[model samples]
Target: MNINNAYVIAKKEFGFNIKNHWFLLSSVIFCFLNFIIIYFGEIISGDYSQTDIRSLSLSIIHLQMYLIPLFSFILSYDAILSERESGVLDLILSYRVTLLEVMFGKLLGNCIVFTISFLLGFLPVFLYLYFLGIKFLVLFKFVLVSIWLSFIFNSFALYVSNSSKDRTFVILLSIFIWLFFIFVYDIIFTFFVVLFYGSISNYFLNFLLFFNPAEMFRLISIFYFIPNDITDLFGINVSSFNNFYVCLSMFIWVVFVFFSFLFFYFEKK
Candidate 1:
C-alpha cells in the first residue's frame, strides 16, 4: 500500500516493457493499419475513403477490438509467472511492498506501454485527418477506453498466469480467452437468440452483448459519438440499445473485473 514502493515497481516494469520488441513491431503494424483505414479504405471496411469519419471510426474500433486485446494478452500474459519462474517476483515481494502494490504496478506499467504504443501509431493518422476537417475524436476517445481494454485482458492474462503451475497452460489459456471474447462469444450469443427467437427480449439480448468487454467497448465507442438513428458502431439496425443500460452494464463489467483481479492476488502467493 506504500505509494513509493508501488511507484518503484511501476518504474521498473515500465523500463522493462519499454524495450519490448513486440511493442515496437506492433506499433509499426498499427501505423500501417491506420494508413489503410485513412487512404485505402475499401480494403477493410469498404468505407472507400477518409471523408466518412463515422465509418472509418467504426473500422478503427473494430480493428482495435481485435488487435488491442491480442497485444495486451501477449504483452502481459507472462507478467508475473515468468518472473515467478525466474525468482524475480519473489525478489520484488521481499521488498517493503504489498502484493497489491506489485500487481498494480505491473498493470499500470503495461497499460502505459500499450497506450503509448497505440498513440505513436494513432497520432500521425489523426493529424492527417484533422487537416481534412474530419473529426478524429472518436479515435481519441477510444484510445482512452483502450486502457480499460488493456487492463481487462492484462489482468485476465496475469490472473491466468498466476492461477496455474505451467507456463504452457498460461499461454494456451490466453489464446483461448482472446479468441472466445473477440470472436466466438458473439456468435454463440447470436445463436442463443436465434434458438430462442420470440422468447428472448432485445433488451435482455442487448444487455447480454456487453458481458464481453470487446462488444461493450465497441458499443461504448459509438453510443456517445453517433446520432440516435444508429444503435451500434456498425450501424446494423439490430435493436434500440439503451444508453442507460450501456452505462450500467459497463459499470457492472468493470466491477466484475475488479473483483476477479482482487480474488486472484489475495488467494495466490
Candidate 2:
C-alpha cells in the first residue's frame, strides 16, 4: 500500500518491458490484424459504404473475442513467474517494497501497456465505423465493453502468474482460461438448457450470463447496438438490459480477479 514504493516498482516494470522488441512487434502485428479484419469485413459486405455499422462492429467483436483475450494473456502470464524463477522477487522486495506494492506495481504497469495497445489496435475500426454512420456514444460503449474484457483477462493472467510456480502450468491454465470463456462456457449453458428443458426460465438464464466477462462484452454490444425484443446467445436468452447491471458485472469481475490474486497468492507457496 506504499504509494511511493508501488510507483517505483511500476516505473521499473514499465521501463523494462516497453523496450522489449517482441512486445513491440507483437503489438504492431495485433493492430495490423485488427485493421485487416475490419477493412475486409466492410469490403466483403458487398459495399463498404452501405454496410451496417452494427453488423460490422459485431463481427469485429466476435473475431476480436478470440484475439484480444489471448493477447492480454501473453502480456502478463510471465510477469511474476519469471521474476520468482530468476530470484528477482527477493531483490525487488529488498528495496523496501511490500508484496502488495510489488503486485499492484506490476499489474499497473502491464495494464498501462494493455490499455494503450488495445486502444491503438482498435483505432482503425473505430474511425471506419464512425465515418459509416455509427454514433459516437455507441462506439464509445463498444470500446468500454471491449476494454473491460481485456482487463478481466489481464487480471486472470496476472493472477495465474502470481499463484503458479511452474511456467508450463501457467501456460496450460492460460489456454484453459481462454477456452472456457470463449467456447466451453456456452456449451455448459446449452447443456443446462437441455437438462432443464423448459423448467428454467430464460430470464434467470440471461441474468446468469452476466457472470462471464466475455459474454458480457458481446451481450452489451448486442443490447445497445442491436436492440430487439429478445436476444439469444448460444441458447441463453437475454430479455432485459440494465445499465447498472452491465457496469456492475464488469466491475465485479475486475475487482474479484485482482483481489483473488492479492489474497490467495500474496506469498509464494
Candidate 3:
C-alpha cells in the first residue's frame, strides 16, 4: 500500500463530498431541526427551569447518538459499493495500490466528512449552552462521546460498503441494522426478560443489557446526567454500575467492530 496513493484517494473523496451542495444543505436542515425539537420540547414540557445543565447536555448527547449513525450510514453505506457498481473498482484495483490502502483511504475520507458534519450540526447547541453559562466540562464530554458514537457507526457502514455488491441492498441493510440497534433490540430484550421474570438471574440480565448499543448509550447518558449516588431499593449504586459497565461494553464494541471490518475486507479480497 502506497501512502501517496491513499492520500490522493482521500483528498479526492474529501473534495467531492465537501463540494456536494445536497449534502451541505441536508446537514444544515437537520441541525436546525435538532435545535427546534430541543427548544420546543423545553418550552412545551415547561421543564427548562427544572432541568440541570448536565441533563440538558445529556439530551443533546442522546440526540447525537441517534442522528450521527444515520448520517454516517448515508455517507458510507454506498462508498465502496457505489464505486464497485459504477465499474470504478476494477480501474482502481488495476493501480499498484493494494486493496487495504483503498479501503483505509475510503474509510478515512468518509470519517472526515462524518466528523465535519456532526460538529457543524452540534456546534450551535454547544454555543447555546455556553451562553447559558453551562459548565465547559459537560459540553466537552458530550463532544467526546459524540465522536466515539460516530466512529462506531462509520465503521459499521464501511464494513457494509466493503461486503455488499448492491447499493440498494447495502442501504436497506444499513437502515435495518440502525433500527435494530436503536429500537427493536431493546423491545425484544425487554420482552424476553419480562416473560422469564424471576427465572432470570441478575448476572444474566446485566449481560443481556450490554448487547444493545442504545441501552449502553442511555446508561452512559444517565450517568453523565446524574453522576452522584441515586440508590435503588437494593441499596446498590445503580448509576455507578451502569456507568462502568456501559463504558466497558462500548469500548469492547468499538474494537470488535473495527476488527470485524478488517477481517471481512481481507476475506472478501
Candidate 4:
C-alpha cells in the first residue's frame, strides 16, 4: 500500500519491459506498419481536403483495432506468470511490498511504457497530418482514446497472466481473447442482427455492443465521425449514448479485470 514501494516496483517493471528485445521489435514493427497504413489510407480515401478529418481518423481506427490488441497482449500476457515461474515473485513478495503494490506498480509501469511507445509510433504521423491542414484537435482526441483502449486490453492480458502459470496457455488465451473480440464478436453480433433485427430490442443490441471492449472502442472512436445516415442504415442507434458513456465503459472494463488480477494474486498468496 506504500506509494514509494509501488513507485519503485513500477520503475523496475518499466525498465524491464523497455529493455526487452521483444518489446523493441514489436514497437518497431508497430511504428513502421502504422506509418505506412496511415499514409496510404489517406491517399486511398481520395479526400485530401485539409478539413477531412473523418477519413484520416477512420483509417487510424481500423488499424488500431488489430495493432493495439497485439501490442498489449504481447507486452503483458506474462506479467505475473513469468515472474512466478522464475521464482522472482517469491523473492519480490519477501520484501516489505504488498501484493497490491506490486500489481498496481506493474500495471502502471507497463501502461506508461506502452503509452511512450504509442506516442513514438503515432505522433509523427499525427504531426504530419496536422501540417497538411487536418485539424489536430480531433486527432488529439483520437490519440487519447486509443491510449485508453490499449490500457483496457493490457488490463485484460494482466488478468489472464494472473490466472495462469503456463506461458504457452497464457499466450494462446490472449490471442483467443483478441480474436474473439476483434473478429468473432462482430460476426456473432451481425448474425443476430440479421436474424432478429426487428425482434431484438434496441436496448439489448446496445448492451451487446458495449459488452465487447473492442467493439465499444471502435464505436466510440468513430461515433462522432460517422454520418447519421450510415448508422440509421445499420440500425446501430449511436445516439443512445454519448462520449462520456463510452469512456466510462472502457474505464469499467479496466477496473473490472484489474480487480480480477488482484483477486487471483491474493488467493495464491
Candidate 5:
C-alpha cells in the first residue's frame, strides 16, 4: 500500500467534506431541532423532573440511533461507485495506490466526517442534560456509546457501498439493513417470544439479546438511569457483564465489516 497516496486521498476527501455546505447546514439544523424538542417538551408539560429528564435522554438516544445510520449511509453509499461511474477509478488505479489504501482512506474519511456530524448533534443535548443535573458519568457514557455506534454504522455502510456497484442499490440496501436491525428485528423477536410463550426458555432470550444492538443500547441506557431491580426485569445485566466486552464487540464488528469490504474489493479487482 502507498501510505503517502492514501494519506493524500484521505486529506482531499476530508477537505471536501469540511467545505460541504449541505452537511454543515444539516448538522446545525439537527442541533437546533434537538434543543427545540427537549426544551419545548419540558416547557409544555411543566415536568422537568427526573423522570422527564430520563425520558428526554432516552429520546435523544433514539435520535442518535436513527441519524447515525442515515448520515453514514449518505456519506458512504457513493464512495467507490461514483468514481467508477465517472471513469476516475482507472485514473486512481493507475496512480500506484493499492486498492487497500484507497478503500481504507475512503473509509477513514467517511468515519471522521460522520463522527463530527454525530457529535455536533449531541452537543446541545449534552448541555441540556448537564443543566438538568444529570451525573457526569451518565452523560459521558451516553456520548461514548453514541460515538461507538457511529463507528459501527460507518463500517456497515462502507461494507455495503463496497459490495455494490449501483449507488441507489447501496442506499436502499443500507436503509433495509438499518430498518431490519432497528425495528423489524425486535418485532420479530417479540413475535417468537409470544408464540413460544411459556415454552420458551431463558437461554433463547439471552441469545437474542446478545446479537441485538438496539436492545444492547437500550439496556445500557436504562441501566444508567433505572434501579437494578427494574433492569433485571428488562433481561439485561449491565453490571454483571464486563463493559469491556461491549466495547470489544463493537470494535470487532467495525473491524469485521471493514475486512469484509477489503475482501470484496480485492476479489473483484
Candidate 6:
C-alpha cells in the first residue's frame, strides 16, 4: 500500500471530477434547492411568527433522502466499470499502485468531491439559519447526518460499479436500487404496518428501518430534530434506540458495503 501513490490517484480523480463539471453541476443544483428551502422557510415564518429550526431541518432531510441517493448513484455508478471497459483500469494497474490503493484513492476522491459540493451548497443556508437565530448545534448535527447519508449511498453505488462489467446494466441497477431504498422501502413498510397493525412488534419495525439507510436517516431526523406530531401524523413510532445506535448502524452499513466492494473489485482483478 503505497500511500503516496494512493494520494496521487485520489487527487487526480478529484481533479478530473471538478474539471468534468460533475462537482459544479451538483453544487449548483443543491445550492438552488437550498435557497428555495430557505425562501420557503422565510415565507412560513412570516405567517407563523416562528419557524422552528427542526422543521427546516426535517424538510431538508426528506429531500436529502431522495436526492442524495440519486446523486450518489449517478456520480459513482461508472466509477470502476467504465475504467475497466475503457482500459483505464489496466493502464492504472501498470503503475506503482496496488488495486486496493487505487480503489481507496477513487473512494477518497469521490468523498472529497461530495464533501466540497455539500458544503458549498449548504453553507449559505447555514448562514441564513444562523441569522434567523437558529442554534449552531442543530445546524451542525444536520450537516453531519447529511454527509454520512451521502457517504452511505456513494459506497453502495461504488459497489454496483465494481460488481458489473456492463455500464448499461450498472446504470439500470443503480436507478433501481435508489428507487427501492428511497421510495419502495417506505411504502412497503407502511403497507405492512397498515395491514398487520398490532401483529408486528415495534422492535421488528425498527429492525427493518435500520437496514434501509434512507429510512434510517428519516427516522433518525424525526427522533433527533422533528417534533413528535410529525411522527404521529405518519403513524411512525419513534424507536426507543438512541441516536448513537442509528449512527453506528449507518457507519456499519458504509463499512460493510465498502469492503464488499473492495473484495469483489480485487477478486475480479
lDDT against the true structure, per candidate, is 0.75, 0.76, 0.70, 0.77, 0.69, 0.78
- The residue ranges of model 3 lying beyond 4 angstroms of the native Cα positions read 1-5, 47-59, 197-203, 228-237, 240-247
Poorly placed runs, candidate 6 (over 4 Å): 40-55, 227-234
Residue-level lDDT tens digits of model 4 in 1-269: 68898899899999998777555676677678877876676577675553355665666677888898888988888888988999998899898777778777888898888888888778777787678665667678777777887888888887788767877889889989999999999899988988997876877888888788777767776764453433662465656667677668877887777677677767867
List runs of model 1 lying over 4 Å from the truth: 42-54, 131-136, 224-229, 232-247
lDDT of 4: 0.77
Residue range 48-159, candidate 5, lDDT tens digits: 6633765576666666667666676677767777877888777888878776777778877776776677577667767767877888788888767766666666667666
What is candidate 4's TM-score against the reference? 0.87
Candidate 5 structure, TM-score to reference: 0.84
- Clash pairs detected, candidate 2: none
- What TM-score do all the candidates reach, one by one? 0.85, 0.89, 0.83, 0.87, 0.84, 0.88
lDDT tens digits by residue: candidate 2, 1-269: 68888788778788777777445665677678767777787678878557766566677777777877888899888988999999999898887777778777887777777767767767766787788777889888887877777777877887888767989999999999999998999789778777986788877887767667787787877776766623655555566567877777778887787777667644542
| RMSD list, candidates in order | 3.1, 2.4, 3.4, 2.8, 2.9, 2.6
TM-score (C-alpha, index-matched) for candidate 1? 0.85
Name the best candidate (by TM-score).
2
Question: Candidates 2 and 4: which is better by lDDT?
Answer: 4
RMSD of 4: 2.8
Candidate 6 residues 145-253, lDDT tens each?
A: 7788888888778778877788788989998999899889889988988988888777787787878888877776666565464347347565466767766887788
Model 1: per-residue lDDT, tens digit, 1-269? Answer: 57787678778888897766666777898889878766656555554453666666667778888988999988888888888899888788887667778777887788888888888877787686567665567556666777677778887777777767698988899999999999999789767876877776666776677678888887776664455524543324444656576557667867887687677667754
Highest lDDT among the candidates is held by which one?
Answer: 6
Name the weakest run of 10 consecutive residues (lDDT summed) in model 5: 229-238
- Model 5 spans with C-alpha error above 4 angstroms: 48-51, 197-204, 225-242
